[model samples]
Target: MLRFIMQFVIILATLAAGNALSSVFHLPIPGSILGMFLLLLGLLTGVVKLRWVEGVANSHLRHMTLLFIPPVVGLLLNWGAVHIQLWKVLLVLSLSSLCILLGTGYSVELYEKRKRRRNG
Candidate 1:
């Protein structure tokens, strides 16, 4: 329990620092995003060990779907506004999805090819 609390605190501190940096720099991006980048940098640099926050992160991931519920509900509530732009929204979403799918597929194929070449 104590370790969990400590890990949670670390996460919150990182977010707060990110928020502060965003505000201080008048950044267009959200502070939460900046905080995430900071956390990633820390992990990559080995300044923040994965074991320190892995449990808390996994717990959040487990319930991640629940986090989207509120935003989805909000969107549904404003469906009248969204309905007018439904076609445009659908087109953008479809195109973006396709782009992401193709990009990921190409990347995986490249990675596999490289791996196979190294092994052989």
Candidate 2:
């Protein structure tokens, strides 16, 4: 219980720091995004141990879909505005998804080839 509380406090502190940075710089991006980037940097630099927050993060991930419900409902309720640019939105989404798929496929193939070369 104490560990969970400590991890939660650490996450909140990181978020608060990110919020402060966004507000100070008048950044267009949200504080949560900044906090996420900060957390990523910490992990990559080995400043933050994954074990410290992994449990809580995974618990949140299990209910991740629930988090999208509010935004989805809001979008549905304001469908009039969304419908006006529906085609444009669909076009962007389709193109982006296609790009992501192709990019991921190419990346995986390259990784596999490199691994095979190293092993052989």
- Per-residue lDDT of model 2, residues 27-80, tens digit only: 999999999999999999999999998988888889999999999999899987
Alpha carbon deviation, residue 60, candidate 1 (Å): 0.8
**In model 2, how large is the Cα lDDT of residue 17?**
90
Off by over 4 Å in 2: 80-82, 85-88, 99-120
- Alpha carbon lDDT of residue 22, candidate 1? 97
Alpha carbon deviation, residue 67, candidate 2 (Å): 0.7
Tens-digit lDDT track of model 1 for 7-80: 99999999999999999999999999999999999999999999999999999889999999999999899987
Clashes of 1: 0
**TM-score for all models, in order of appearance:** 0.73, 0.66
- Clashes per candidate, residues 3 or more apart or on different chains: 0, 0
Each model's Cα RMSD:
3.4, 3.8
Cα lDDT of all candidates, in order?
0.96, 0.93
